[model samples]
Target: MPLPVPDRLCDLPYAHLLTPHTGPLRSDERYDTVHFDGGEYTDQRAGGATFLECAFTGVALSGVKLRQARFNEVWAQAGRWVGCDLSESEWQDSAVTGGVLAGVSAHGSALRRTVFRGCKLEAVNLRAAVLRDVVFEDCLLRDVDFGDARLTDVSFPGTTLEEVRLRGARLSRADLRGAVSLGLPDGHQGLQGAVISSTQLLELAPQFAHALGITVKD
Candidate 1:
């Protein structure tokens, strides 16, 4: 299954038409219709900023602080956001393609209509976050934490979730049917509102039985 392209790209402005964004980002500053191309920003702080209709291509962001930042109609591709502090941020109508986001602190964040395609997300902290209509297609999610999170209409198609933590997470219409691998370290209790395939359920029967204290003696 393929991921849907972001609608924001339909009205993408040309490079010359886009404003080049450089220098340090200020808090509460609103950036609209801007482009960040091949920029390397590390350890920068940009909390409480709002970005609308922006594009980030080949950008490298490491150890950056972007707490409470809002992203709308954003297209990010071929970017590396490692060790970023994105906690409490709000992302809407954004698409991240072929990006590598590792060791990100996105706890308590809210993401709506966001799609991650062909991206690698490792050790992302999404605890207590709220996600709606989010999809991970052809992506890799390893060591991701979803503790106390609320997910609605979230699906993982052609994605692998390895060593994910989901303790106390709430799911509604979360489709794991298309996942290549679903490795939930916190067990089935955290999958109460999720929808899985029959094959997946059979594979997890042992864990379910153990959770119920039902000893199955072969």
Candidate 2:
């Protein structure tokens, strides 16, 4: 099984003035094609909000809670997000590049046709999320949780996955050849159609044997 090539991101223009952040954000509001460049947002809560064709460049978000939000065709580059909660959010056709996301929780989110490149993800929780046609390249993911997530056509190249939890997560045509420290726990049964190198297979032999209920002989 091979990975599906995702569509290229389109450039969206900013047509509105820069709205200064002051208090709590509105829910179910449409942020129509706004551009956030070099902006800093703090303590904003935008649950169930929609961001269509928006671009976020060099933006910094701290203490933001966007639970169940929707981001369609958004491009976020060179941004930093700390302590943000995006649980159950829907991010479709989005590209997040060169970003540092620390302590962000996106548990049960849906990420379709998304690309996350050259980013540092620390303590990010994506448990039970739906990930389809996602590419995570050259990213450093530490303590990230992908438990029970459905991954289809997902590839992780040149990425460091340390302490990542992938229990019961399905993989369809996922390429992890260049990933480092990718240790699957014992009895992991969702590695079908996953591509890895010989070295990785050898390193994961113990877990594989355990999954097969095989006992090593002395």
Candidate 3:
């Protein structure tokens, strides 16, 4: 068997012509090539389910158990998922736009080639997760935790990360060049492998200086 290519470029998801679906999201169920439009799947238990080539529009899911769920080639728009348990879930080639995810527990999740555009992720727990080639474009990630997580080739373009926790997180080629605000309340020790522009550095110099106990006299 050939070795796995780590640096291979990931292709974006194509337009899908899917079958309309109307049913409860059950555990261990596989939803393939289905479109969930204008559905309310709140307070449901869909642990260990697999969603492939699926699309969600205006879906509402609160306090849902989606642990160990698998998602591939999925597209979600304008979905409201609050306080959902999505820990240990794996997502590939997924795109979520204009979604509201608040107080979501998604720690230890693996997300590859995923894009979150114009989404609001407030107080989401993503500690110890592994993200590769993922982009957060024009998103608001406030109070999101990524402690001890491994991030590779992740870019946050046009995003504002407010009070985001990065303590003990590992970053490789993590680009924050286009982030409107990088609010790291945990200091800057875990950003050893990240790339930031000089302007950002200058803006954050005072914070880092305070953390290092260095006083600059003007």
Candidate 4:
């Protein structure tokens, strides 16, 4: 059986079912236990809106801005967020699956125990974010920036990362055993407790040597 996708907020009985708002979303609105399905939003601004225990299914968001939004225990599946601004958002214990997120800016965000599975995230900016116990499984991450981020117990299994920037990122006990095409930026101090395969270690040998100030002679 396949994993169930998020379609409705079953926990909330009296919640509002929002059809696509057409224009920009109201700022600082608290949408608790709201459910959205197959809706389309373009160039909308939902900054500072609070989403608690919400569910979004097959929603299409284009150029939507959710900057400083708060999502607590939210679930999103089969959603497409293109060129969206999610900077400084806070997501806690949420799950996102089968989503396509392109050019999403999440700078200075805080994500704790969030899971992103089977998602394609391109050019996502996570600079200076605080991610704890986050997991990225079976995802394609291209040009994702993690600069100055704090990652604790973050796992990336079966994930392919391309041009990922980890400069000044602080990793404590991160798991990267199943990551592919991984390369750290100039400073490597961020990968202290990261778990990598032997092949990956061999591939990064030269960079490791350079970081250690060791000259290898054949």
- Top model by TM-score, which number? 1
Candidate 2, 1-218: lDDT as tens digits: 22232323233333343343334457787886676777788888788999887777788999888999999877788899999999999998888989999999999999988889899999998989998888888899888888888888888888988877777788887778878668554234567667888998888888888877899998
For residue 189, what is the lDDT in candidate 1?
A: 62
lDDT of 4 by residue, 54-99 (tens): 7888999999889999998778889999999899999987889899
What lDDT does each candidate get? 0.89, 0.80, 0.88, 0.82
Ranking by lDDT: 1, 3, 4, 2
In model 1, residue pairs whose N, Cα or C atoms come closer than 3 Å (at least 3 residues apart or on different chains), thus clashing, are: none
- Candidate 4 residue pairs that clash: none
Off by over 4 Å in 3: 1-17
Candidate closer to the true structure by TM-score (higher is better), 1 or 4: 1
Ranking of all candidate structures by their TM-score, best first: 1, 3, 4, 2
Clashes of each: 0, 0, 0, 0
TM-score of each: 0.94, 0.83, 0.91, 0.86
**Candidate 2 or 4, higher lDDT?**
4
Per-residue lDDT tens digits for candidate 1, residues 40-147, read 998988899899988998999999899999998788989999999999999888889999999999999999999999999999999999999999999999999999
lDDT of 1 at 198: 98
Error of 3 at 44 (Å): 0.9
Model 3: per-residue lDDT, tens digit, 24-57?
A: 8899999988888888877899999999988888
